[model samples]
Target chain A: MDRKMSPETRSALEKLADWFRARSIWMLHYCTGCGAVELPPSMTSRFDMERFGIGPMATPRQADVLLITGYLATKTLRRVIYTYEQMQTPKYVIGFGSCTINGGIYYDSYNVITRLDLYLPVDIYIAGCMPRPEAILTAFNKLREMIEKGEANGWKRYEENKEWYRANQLKALNGEVYVTR
Target chain B: MNLKELISELKNKYRVLDEKFNDPNHTFVSIVPDQLHAALGELKSYGWKHLSTISCVDWIDDNEFELVYHLWNWDSRSQISLKTRISRSNPHFPTIMHIFPTAKYYERDIHEFFGVEFDGNSEMEPLFLEFWDDIPPMRKDFDPLKYSREKFGERDYKVPFADFIVEEGDQK
Candidate 1:
C-alpha cells in the first residue's frame, strides 16, 4: 500500500478520484471540545455547508473526512485514532482550531494533547480559539480546493508514515509500557 | 425561618466556632472536623434539606484540606456553607450519605481529585479523570505545567517570531 506509483499512473487515477472527492465530502463529526458550538451555524441556513456537499456522517466508515472540532484530551485522542483508522481510504482530517494546532489556552493543560497532527494526519487547519462559522466555511472551501488539486494526501501520508505516527501516538499515550504494566 | 432566628438556634444547640455572613441569603460556618457529621445531620433535620455540593480545598501551606458542605434551605431561601479542616497528610472523612444520599457522587469526586477517602462510601471508585496513574491532580504540589511538558510534547518553533519581524520598507 505504501509503494510509490509511476507519475503517469498516479496522475491519471488521482485526477479522477480528486474530481469526485472535491464535490462530495462526508464528514465524521467527532466533536470533543468547546469548538463544537461553531459547527451548528456553519451547517445551518445562514452558512449551509451542505450547499458545497459537505455533510455529517454518523460513523467513520461512511465518511471521507474526520472533523476534529476542538481540544483532544489523552482519553478522547484514543477514540479519535480508532475513528480515524476506521475512515475509508483517501480520508482527510480537518483540525478545527488553535486547540488542534497548538492546544490553544489548554497549552499547559495536563489532560489535553498539545497537537492533533502527531496522532493523525491533518489535511487542513482552521486557526482560531473557536473559529467563527464563516471561518469554518472558508476552511471547507479550502479543503475542497485541495481535494480538487489532489494536494490533500494526508491519508497516503498516514499510510507511508504509519510507524512514525504510531510511535508518536505511543509516546503521547504513554506507549506499551502503560499497556503492559 | 429568619436568618437571626436560625443563627441563634444553631448557637443555642451547639458550639459554633466561627460564622460569617457573605450576604443576606448566604452564611458560612467553620467547625472542628469531629463535629462535621453531627452538624450536617442537625442542619438536615432543621429543614436545611438541600445539599448543594460537597467541595474540598487543599490548604497545602497549612497542611490541611478544608471540606465545605454547602446546604440550602428552600423554605427560608438561604444557603449555608458548613466547613471543617482535616489533616492533609491523612485526609480521611466520614461519608454523610445518611444525611444526604446525593453525597455519594460528591464523595467520589473528592476521592478522585483530592485523594480524600470517605469511609462508608463503598462505591468510591473514580467519578472523573479515568485511569489516572499519578497523584490526585487538584493538589497544590501537582504541577500541571510540568506534567503537561513531560506528557504532551510542545511544538518546537524553528523560527522565532521576533526574528522574522520586518522593519518599515525593509522588504524592498
Candidate 2:
C-alpha cells in the first residue's frame, strides 16, 4: 500500500483535475477600462456566457481568471497588481483589447502603460480596440482549451518570475506598489 | 434681465478690459484680477447662479496664464465666460469659493494641472494625478511624450517603419 503515486498515475490525476478546472472558470469582474462595455452583452441573454460554465466572480479570492480590459493607467495598474496577486493559484490573465497589448490610442499618453506583459504574465490577448462579444466568447473557448491542456499557467510563471514582474511594476508605478496579505 | 443689460451693468461697476459676443447666447468679458471677486459677487446676485467650471490656459508666448470662469444664468438661458490674466511666474489667483462655493474643486483641478495657486482654497490636493514627480503635466513646457517614455517604458520596434516607404512602381 504505497501512498506516493507513480508518474503514470500522477499524470492521469492531473488530467482529471484539468478537466474539472476547464469546465468551470470564474473570472473576477474587475473592469479596468472601456472594454468592459462588451462584457454586459456577453454575460446576458444575447451571448449567454453562463452556458459555457464561465461566469463573473465578485472577489478575486474565488476567481480562476483575471480579465484586464483595455488601457491600464499607472494609477490603476498598482491596484490591478494587488488584485492579481490576491487571486488564488492556478490563475489566468486575459489581456483584453489592443490597449492592453501596446497601449492602442494611448500609446504616447503620460499616464497609460504601453505593455501589460511586462508587469504580469498574460495567458491570452484579445485584439481590437474592443473585441466584440463573439470574439470574447471565442477567447473564452480558446482559454478553456488552453486550461485543459495545462498551457495557460500564467500564475506559475508569475510565481517563478516574481522579481522581474515586481521591478516592472515598481518602475511604472513610481516605486509605490505593495501587495499586502 | 437680458445679456446686453447685464453687460452694461457689469461695465458700470467693474473696469471691463474687453468684451466680445461670440454668439447670440455666449459672451466673453475680460476684467482685471483685482475686480474679479467683486464682479463675480455682483454677477451671482444678478442671477448667474451656476458656476459651470473654472478652466485655465497656459499662454507661454505672452508669459501669462488665463483663468476662465464659466457661469450660466438659468433664467436668461445665456452663458458668461469671465476671463482674467495672471502673471505666468506668479500664477496666484484668489479663490472664488466664498462667492460661488463650487469653485473649490475647480480651483483644485486648476492648481493640479496648471500649477495655479488659488489663495484661499485650502483643499488644493492633487485632484487627478497620484505621486506626480515632474512639473504640472498640463503646462506648456512639459513634454508629455518625453515624460511618458521616461516613466512608462516605450515599445521597442525592431523595424524602422519611417524608412520602409513603398515606391509607386513597387505596387505593381
Candidate 3:
C-alpha cells in the first residue's frame, strides 16, 4: 500500500497552505531619513496602498512589515534595532532607497551607517535615492507574495539565535556587552 | 495650500524675501532669519506637520551661510523649502520646535553640525561628536582642508614608493 496521504491529513495540509498564501501585512512607519517622504504618497490615494491589502502600522509589535526608509545614524540605528526586535512573528523587512542599501550620497557620510543588514535581516530592497511611489507599491506586492509563499520566515530566524540577537539588542539598550560569561 | 498659492501669499507678506526657486515639485522661499518663523507659521496653518530637515551651506567666498528648512506638508503633497541667512559672526535663531515638535530633533542635529544655536530648544543637546570641539567644521568659514593639512602634517608617500621602485630597478 502507498504510505503518503490520509484523507483528513491532506485536507488539513491544504488549508494550512491556503492560510499562509493569504497573509496580508501592515508596515511600520519608521523612516530615519529622506526616503520616508515617499511613503505618504505611496500609501495615499496616489498609489492606493489598500489595493494590495497593505497599510502602515504605527507600532512594531502588531505589524508584519518593517519598512526602513533611509540613513541610520548610529543613534537612530539603536532605536531601529529595538523596533525590529519588538515586531511579532511573521515579520518582514523592506529596505527602502539607496541609503538603506549602501548609504547612497551618504556613502561617505561619517554619521550614517553604511550597511543596514549588519543590524537586521532585510528581505527586499527598493533601489533608488528615493524610490518612486509605483516602485514602493511594487515592492509591497512582492513582499506580500513572498509572505504568502512562506518564503520569508521572520520568527524562525529569531528563534534560532535568540541569545545572540538578545546580546546585540542589549548592547544598544545599555552600555554593557549583554553576554553571560 | 499648494506651493503656488503659498508662494503668492509669502510674496505679499514678507519684504526681505529673495527670488524663489521652483523645481518640478519643490518651491523654496529665501528670507532673512527674522522672517523665518512668520513664514513657517503660514505653512503650519495649512497642514505642514513635518520639518524634514535643516541643511546648512557655508559659502566663505560670499561671506554668508545658507540654512534651508525642508518641510513636508502631507495635505498639499509638496515640500516647501524655506531659506534663511545669518551673519557669520554669530549665527543664532529662534527654535521653531514650539510650532513643530519635529524641528527640535533636526535643530539639535544642525546645532552640532553647524554650531548654530536655537534659543528656545531646551532639549538641544549633542547627539554626535562625543567629545571634541574646534570651530564648527560645517560652517562656511571653517576650512576642513586647512585643518586636515595642519593636523596630518603634509608628507609625500608617493615619493618613498617611487624611490623604492627605483632602488629595485637598480638592483635588477
* Candidate that scores best on DockQ: 2
What is the per-residue lDDT of model 3 for residues B66-109, given as tens digits with 9 covering 90 to 100?
Answer: 88988887876788788888765687888988788888888888
Reference interface contacts recovered per candidate: 0.57, 0.60, 0.00
**Scoring each candidate complex against the real one, what DockQ results?**
0.50, 0.58, 0.03
Candidate 2 lDDT over residue span B1-172, tens digit each: 8899989988998999999999988999999999998988888888899999999999999999999999999998999999999999989988888898888999999999999999989899887877778889889999988887777777675557867878888875
Best by TM-score: 2
TM-score (all chains, Cα) for each model: 0.88, 0.90, 0.48
* Pairs of colliding residues, candidate 2: none
Q: Residue B33, candidate 3: how far off, in angstroms?
A: 27
- CAPRI quality of model 1: medium
Off by over 4 Å in 1: A1-11, A174-181, B158-172
- Could you give the TM-score of chain B for each candidate, in order? 0.89, 0.91, 0.79
lDDT for each residue of candidate 3 in A1-181, tens digit (9 for 90 to 100): 1212233443566557635544567889787788888888887887788877787777888888888888776566677777887887667778898776766676544445555654576778898888899999888878776655555554555566667555554433334322232
Better of 2 and 3 by TM-score: 2
Per-prediction interface RMSD in Å? 1.6, 1.2, 10.0
What's model 2's overall lDDT? 0.88
Looking at model 1, the pairs that clash are none
Docking class of 2: medium
